[model samples]
Target: MADVHELQSLLGSGEELTIVCHNNPDPDCLASALALGRLAAAAGIDERRILYSGEITHQQNRAFVNLLDVELKPFDPELVVDRSERSLLAFVDHSVPGANNAVPEGTAVDIVIDHHPAEDVQARYVDHREGAGATATILAEYVRDAGLDVDATLATALLFAIRRETLGFLRGVTAAEYEAGGFLHGHANDDLLAKLSTPSVSGATVDAIADAIDNRSVTGSVLLTHVGRTSERDALPQAADYLVTLEGVQTAIVFGIIEDTIQLSGRSTDARINVGTVLNEAFGDVGSAGGHREMAGGEIPLGIFADYTSDDDQLVAIVEQVVRARLLAELKLSEEDGGE
Candidate 1:
């Protein structure tokens, strides 16, 4: 159990606190930040800011923010400097500062609340549980333990966060997550959740899915596809989710070029192979990668891809081949054996 009382004690009177979400925050991250903000306010903290650095490019995520009315500020270094003496920085959903967050390495962090695998993050207070499906689950525990009143908005956000993170209890979920869901179900707005879950998709998303289906390759139960250059990076994950539902597929690896970097998203139904560790071992040398047991994502700069070829088609081909081969190898499925 995490200690909410200790957290309350950390925020002294009149001190400012800033809660930061990881880059490209999803529903889980946003919800966790909002819940924490409320907790801080309840603890009598006068000044608090919820900050995130990356764009919320996913339509569902954008809808969630707008519909839920969760307030977030764009991260500004000036804010940290202005309140340096009185500021206490806390990270939610992401533990490693500068790994996938805007915070730089070596900067002091006051608190870390996350459900991701633990890393060596130096913070005054840390609560990390790898078993929990969503960070929002941890936040829900805090709200419940402290006997804090969870309004409809906060309840809906937390409930939605758990659902999204766990894929409706289908992936990487534990008993605690179910309990958290049950707790939030009574308080959350069911109508708002229905609206948030089913947002309108753009033409780009459909085109991306088509590209993924056309370009997909199968090896045993693994499906690999590159959606070429996608305008919306979120479409990669959506494509992966769709691909994994295919009859013979137990794992899906989807990648697309956005801006200058190749964005990767993977989903796995097989419990034996940890998708997060596979991604980390395969791409950690070249770029950043890590997540939960069932789903993970990564990014590699185009400069690295450019090292092999300058031709656009050749670059895409080489990237696809290299990434697929590396992933398959990591999953212990040989090309000859996995191929249909």
Candidate 2:
């Protein structure tokens, strides 16, 4: 458990606090930011704001925000730079200052609270527990230990965050996450959670999933596919989740091009294979990639797309071949092994 006293002391008095979430903020990131904002309020910080840079295009994430009335403002680089002297900056649900997050590189961070693998980032206070399932679980501990008031809205958000991050406790979950879920269960609104769980999927998501199915290639227990062009990057993860459910499939890697960037999402049920590490090894050299053991994501700019002036199908086919070969080689699989 992190020292609540130290966190409060870092905030000091009459200092504005800005809580920055990672790009394309998920339920865990949003809920963790809100929960920490509540902590700041309890610590007597009057001026504080929760900010995120990327779009929240996930249906469930949108529903969670609407159902809970969680407020998050857009990050303003100018405002952050201007307020750098008088304000304190804190990050939640992300460890490194700039990796895959809105915070600029080399920015001095006051506090960092996360559940992912820790990176070598300089911060005055960092509470990173790689064993924990969700960052919300860490914040829930602060709320519990400090005896802070957790309203129904915050409790429901925290509980939902934990559930989504852990895939209803089916993924990487520890005793701390279980305890947090149990504690938040008492205060969370059951009706609201049920509503948030059943978000309507968009047509794009359906098409993306179908494309993944059509393009899927299996080598032993590994499955890889490309969904072509996608309007929503979140659909890649949904497709990857669906692919991993196929019979005899131990790992699934799905990729799609979104706005001239190739986004990849991977899921693994095999305990011995860490999908995050696999993605980092495969794509980290050319792009940014990393996540938890069971789930991970990465993105690479589609500069190669400009090399081909041919039709879209041809371009996608070439890119898919390149990506598939790289991933298979990293996974120790080969095309000659009847993958296609």
Candidate 3:
């Protein structure tokens, strides 16, 4: 449990509070923010004044926010503004200051609650647990232990976050996570959970999947696919998961340029391969990358993609070659010998 006294003190001090999530906020990020905001409001804080960053991009995430009636004021990333001295900032789901879902540099953060690896933080209060499936799981504990009442909508929001971010508890989950999940499950709206879990399929998603399948190439046990450009960032991970189901395909790499960034999503069923390491080796020099052992994602800037566009096919071929090289290294296959 977090320090209730500290939270109480912040509330008593009457500080302006802002809650920020990472760019492209997912279900966990949005739901956790909503839960925290609800708690604060119940304790006499004004819900209308709280500021939130990022636009809801994923369909289910948008639905969760709408269903919960979570009120959030818009925040601008490009605007130069002062971080209120009396303002308290609480970051959820991430720790690093410049991480994908982090407050911009020079902004003071007062609290951080996360399930990712700990990083340097200026926040006075920090509770980080990588073992938890999602930050929403930890936040749910705070709500339940506070003996505060969460409405059915808020309950469903948290439940959806836990399920979506954990991939139905198949990734980065622990025993305590299940306990928290069970608690939320008891009170969460089953109908809303079902609807959010399976959002209506979009035609663009189908087109993207077809493009991925048509462009897929096999080299040894490595399956590589480049889908050129995409507006659906979330689909990259879905494509990665689908590609790994192919026979003899132990590792899968899906790459696509989205907006100004080139995204890479990698997945592996083999215990020997660390997709995180492969991601770091492949894009660490060019951009930022990180994740779990079996599933990892990375993003390189548009500059790198532009450089490769001189010969589009050659550039994709090079990416595949690099990924295969990393996979072969993981498999202990010599360059002279073919991949496993």
Candidate 4:
């Protein structure tokens, strides 16, 4: 549970508040930042800003920000330095300072309100509830208890964050999520929700999905596919999500060469396998990756093969072979069991 009064006290004490969102934020992180901003506003913090480390690559995320007119700034190192007596920095959705975000490891954190599983959190006021389906669900509790009038924009964002994080109340749905959804449902704008749910799917995304479908390999119940190159990093997760629904397939791994790195996304419905652990075991030494048991994503620098090749086609081919072999070995599937 969140220390509501302490959060308010921390906000009130600070002249300026910086709410930091995790890198490549999804709806849950963005909504949590917005809700925290509202709390800061109510607490008399005049200068409050939401900052994030990476690009908002997903279609729904871009739509969420534009349609709601959300004012977010890209994180800068200097923003961490302020001359004010009481400068507060809060982290939402992600806990570790330098792990998933650009914030330095030793930077002081005034408050942390999150739903992700974490440990050794060193914030003055911490509310890290892994039980909550979405961090927005925890924020909704504070907003309701504070007796603030929930605006339509915030309500819609919060409600959608909860729904999207839990996959429309189908996965990881808890009682708190249902309560949060119920609280925001009446105040949420149905039209805006409809628009946010169905944004303009990019041509790049369609092409990536087509590539994933065209080039797929299977081993036992595990499926792996790589989209050679794409400008859209978010397409990897969408492709993985689609592949998981294939009959007889319990796990799906979708990877692509985006920019200079290999972006990998995985989804698993197998009770015996934890996709997050498997992904980390497969690629954590060479890159950064981790997530829940059911879904995971990672990025590996192309520098691993920088001296080996320069051609785009050749680079992708190397990544495909390496990624497939690594995941297969991690999954404990024999080479003979693997087939396209």
Top candidate, metric lDDT: 4
How do the residues 30-57 of candidate 3 rate in per-residue lDDT, one tens digit apiece?
A: 7888877766776666732434554565
Candidate 4, 234-309: lDDT as tens digits: 9888998899899888899999987778889999889899888898889989997877777888888888676787
lDDT of each: 0.87, 0.86, 0.72, 0.87
TM-score of 3: 0.85
lDDT of 4: 0.87
lDDT of 4 at 326: 91
**Descending-lDDT candidate ranking:** 4, 1, 2, 3
lDDT score, candidate 3, position 15 = 46
Model 2 poorest ten-residue lDDT run: 77-86
| Counted clashes in each candidate structure | 0, 0, 1, 0
Candidate 2 global TM-score: 0.97
> What are the per-residue Cα lDDT tens digits for candidate 1 across 1-340?
6898898787654377898889989999999989888888888787888888978989989999999988889988766545566588889999877888887777778889998875786788888888888999999999998788989999999999999998888888889899998899999998999999999999988999899999998888898899887788899999999899999988899998887888899999987868889889999998889887789999887776767676778888888888888997898887786555
lDDT of 3: 0.72
Best by TM-score: 2
Q: TM-scores across all candidates?
A: 0.96, 0.97, 0.85, 0.95
The deviation in Å at residue 149 for candidate 3 is 0.4
